[model samples]
Target: MDVEKLTKALQWRGFTVERFATAAEAADWMDQAIDGVSVGFGGCLTAEQMGLYPRLSAHNRCFWHWQGDSRDDASRSDVYITSVNALAETGELINIDGTGNRVGATLWGPKEVYFVVGRNKVAPDFDAALWRARNVAAPKNAQRLKRKTPCAVRGDRCYDCKSPERICRGLVVLWEKPTAFEKMTVVLIDEDLGL
Candidate 1:
């Protein structure tokens, strides 16, 4: 991936971009950058991969529904951290949510938002990015959550099925840093960290 080009594209769109060679580096940087604040998480495998919760929680009041905290508590926190399903090199960020909490917070809730992205999630363009979100990320997430959707059963691409367990119900595309937020930062890591 063209890290410099992607960085420029993200920067041009008003997002503060931070590049790192590894997930651990990014996580460590974030742990130090944010302190004593209530931090919330959107269902993020990337953060899990980096062992982020424990690192951040040592100093920050962190909430994650995946770890027994309420989703509402997460949404109401001072900062929100999550990963994108797909990131277009053109600078658009894409996320497919089964529950609205993740995308919803990105749109308006937090004082600041941080997206932790790995190289695997970056696509060449908008079309490729959306395709990755729908086909690659969504299906993998279904399997992880054991949702029993067609995509999960098939262990492949998305069927765009009508199954009630479908995890692709809500799609959010960030063309730029959202207007209401104080800031949105994109933490780009070069390794393959998550699905």
Candidate 2:
């Protein structure tokens, strides 16, 4: 992947991009960046892989519904942290969310939003990014959740199934930084961290 090109594109599109050699380094940077702030976490495997919940919770009021915390409260936090399913090198971010909370918070209602993206999530272009989200990320997520969706059981690409257990009901493509947000940062990690 052309990391430099991607970083330049993201910057041109008004996103603050920070590249890290590893997820741990990025997590450490995040821990310091959001110190003393009220932080909220969306359902992000990347964040979990980085061990951010415990690190952030030590210094910030961090809420993650995946840990049985209140989703409503997390949505209203001072800052929102999450990961996208795919990030286009051309500067588009693709995310598939089962519930609207993750995408909703990403769109608005936060002072700042931080996206923790691993190198494996980057795609060559927008179409490829969307494809990655649907075919790769979605299936892996469904399998991880132990859902009975066709994608999970079939062990292949998305069938666009009508199963109620589908975790990809909402698709979001963030081409530019939201005008309502005070800041939007994309932390790019070198290692592959999550599905």
The 0-to-1 C-alpha lDDT of every candidate, in the order given, reads 0.94, 0.93
lDDT string for model 2 (70-124, tens) is 8778889999999999999999989999988999899878899999999999999
Tens-digit lDDT track for model 1 on 1-195?
888899999999999999999888998899899899999999999999999899999999999999999999999889999999999999999999989999999998889999999999999999999999999999999999999899999987999899988888899999999899999999999999889
Which one is best on lDDT?
A: 1
Position 111, candidate 1: lDDT? 93
Local error of candidate 1 at residue 123 (angstroms): 0.5
lDDT comparing candidate 2 with the true structure: 0.93
